[model samples]
Target chain A: MSQEPAVIDVPFEPHGLPPSVAGAAATTVSVSVTDLRNLRYDWVASAIPGRLLDAPLPIHSSFYETYHETPIKAANDVPRTIADALRGQLAAQGYRIGPDHADIRIGVIRFHEDIPSAQTMNNCFYNLIPETVSVVAIAAALVEVVDASDRPVFVKYYHAAHKVTPWCSPGQPIWAPSLLSLYRTNLIAAMRDMVGQIIGDSHFQEALAKGGRP
Target chain B: MKGAVIALAACALLTACGSIRFAVPYPSVGTPARTPGAANEIVNVVAKDDRTDPGGAVGRNGWQTLVPSNDPAGALAGGMRAELAARGYTVAPGHAQATLDLVSFAVDFLPNDLPLQASPGAPGGTVIATVGIIVIVRDPVARPVFAHYLQVHAAKPYYFNTSNAPDARTVLSEAMQSAITGMIADPAFQQAARRAQ
Candidate 1:
């Protein structure tokens, strides 16, 4: 049997970018994000370390079957579809603005949940999600660029959620802005902060490269 | 008088058997294995942890991001079987003098309310989390061969950005992967199964 390589740590490298994003913003860069499962917020952003813009997704509907084992086209259609939508949104915003030398780059990340917590839905808690929560358990990972070295960065992201979309139906086709508009709002705000953090670090790295900041 | 003595003896035997409590039975698969030359010890794993992604610095709507999945018991059992088979072991009901029986396992999500940094109203929100598996392995006499406890800590950046909510799929996948990956990497697990002489 062919075994995979053993996982180990890279001790020489010091800092780390946020795992959920595509890449860091040391300088202006173009990146792509693919949300094949069709997410509402549409994740690519320009964080402090790098910029995670839009990229074509590798979603093949043929990679899967429905929950009932029925043949369905997308391995993760909704998220990937939404990713396409996000790209359109960015282009519409005239994102080609700002400095040519300033931090510009792209990053992409994917998140998934393993199982939804049904029991918690029954129990009442302050921050607990609503009951129709289908436990859209997701598994996530980030693929980014190491701003300091132009190296590709890949990392994992994680979370468990009961609710994915508001239009609660077993087959209603999840990712709807109606259900996620509120969530989308929060994700964008966080992206700005995260991007800023990544970019700031990149600027610091560049300064050292140029023999200290002017 | 004979009846009373018989009852007392039965109670003693029951106590000697050990305690087995399964919090909840969820269907899944896993791999178990027993090291070579260690017939007296068996390490039956129910579920091996999976890997991760990025989402929910703060969950959408300010919900706590990074909640971990509870135990997928069936998966663990299946995983143990597969692992042992790869290692070359005979499975089934048989007495090899000493045996390892999976008595119980539990996975939970509790509110740590623990903050990564700190923020006002951070209440600091609910943490969808996972404390690793509680595996109790018993010897032939039903004594605990090994009892282990672990908590899978998921580290990812998910800020509360009201403008964009994280993809539920992305968040859950990443957290599950991280927790599972960590589980297999744990030194404690290795130590527990290190050929008990």
Candidate 2:
């Protein structure tokens, strides 16, 4: 039997630029962003307790499944997605994207999506059996900024969660949306929400303004 | 039939006997150039796990216990030593001015606020990892110059049967790193370390 790989790399693509300051003119402040995500563990499977057939009850047995069985073609790279999005937003605000000798440096400590599943009552069984599954998408990140001297200037954590699907009955009809598609939707929405929080922070903007100054 | 039932029960017990273990890699500290005088300071670093249950059962998924592969106290100490050394501080025993104690390293799975009824199958929750430490800086005569308690929390979403070892590891790692970072970033801690003889 083949051993399961310790980490499974999932491709991610964040959507368009986060909402920038309306009519906010661009600045000449240059910045560089780094991906500092821990690469050791990647695959976080969503699990649910198994339902016994005879008793029609949930048991301690857990059934685990990944968001994707195999890697999917990503529109943007996995870890780079957040950094790239931040750069894009900064560029929109008229900040120069320079990796070499930038005034402000930002590090992304965490950037990932989690799919949380819960058991709800399914209408199929007259709401008698609490076997219907509901899933939600959650995204979170820890970002830090440093000045030219690499002195820690600011740090903030961001989080966003949204329900992906309502209570889905067990063995629902084939016409329902695929599990992968639901996951993708959740991921995209959560990423956008989280990245938006970072871009819109006044402290973040202030750090950029004061970077590399004497 | 009775014998078959007994055999099945035994199998279940055997499967749940051991915990799922994962190692927490040393957290990467960003930008160690905090204080100009920090490079010359010699910090005697002491780390110990003071938790009552150091068996390392951080959380539970179904019937399985999640634990760290190595001692969490040791890991925290090793990470602290590396971080301090990276900042150009001399980390060694004897006549040390700085001491760190890992009081608690715990990860808890709290069920998320959902409209659905709670059950084993629908166990959706948030994984909250917390790290608590005490930092002490002393004079040459072992007099306490500055002492403070620093605690940090990192959280991630937990999906009933879905969240696994990697999820737990990620949160735990973040908590550990945050604890160290919080300590180093404190203005008081820096002042004490700099004043340590």
Give candidate 1 regions above 4 Å deviation: A1-28, A36-141, A146-184, A193-197, A200-214, B1-197
Top candidate by DockQ: 2
Residue B152 of model 2 has an lDDT of 71
lDDT of 2 by residue, A1-214 (tens): 2224323333444565455553234333444555544322232223221111111111222211111122122234544666666677777765666632234444443333332223222222133334324444445454555556654455444556655445454455412446556655666666677677777889777766555233
The C-alpha TM-scores of every prediction are 0.24, 0.46
Q: What share of the true interface contacts does candidate 1 keep?
A: 0.00
Q: DockQ of each candidate's interface versus the true one?
A: 0.02, 0.05
Candidate 2 segments exceeding 4 Å error: A1-41, A44-76, A99-106, A116-128, A131-133, A165-167, A173-177, A212-214, B1-59, B63-197
- Tens digits of per-residue lDDT, candidate 1, A62-161, equal 2111111111111223334333433333233232222322222222232322222222221212222234342232222222322234321222122222
What is the Å distance of residue B56 in model 1 from its true position? 14
Model 2, position A29: C-alpha lDDT score? 40
**Model 2 TM-score relative to the real fold:** 0.46
lDDT by residue (tens digit), candidate 1, B87-175: 45443332211121221121212222222222332232222322233343333443333433333323233332221123333333344
lDDT of each: 0.29, 0.54
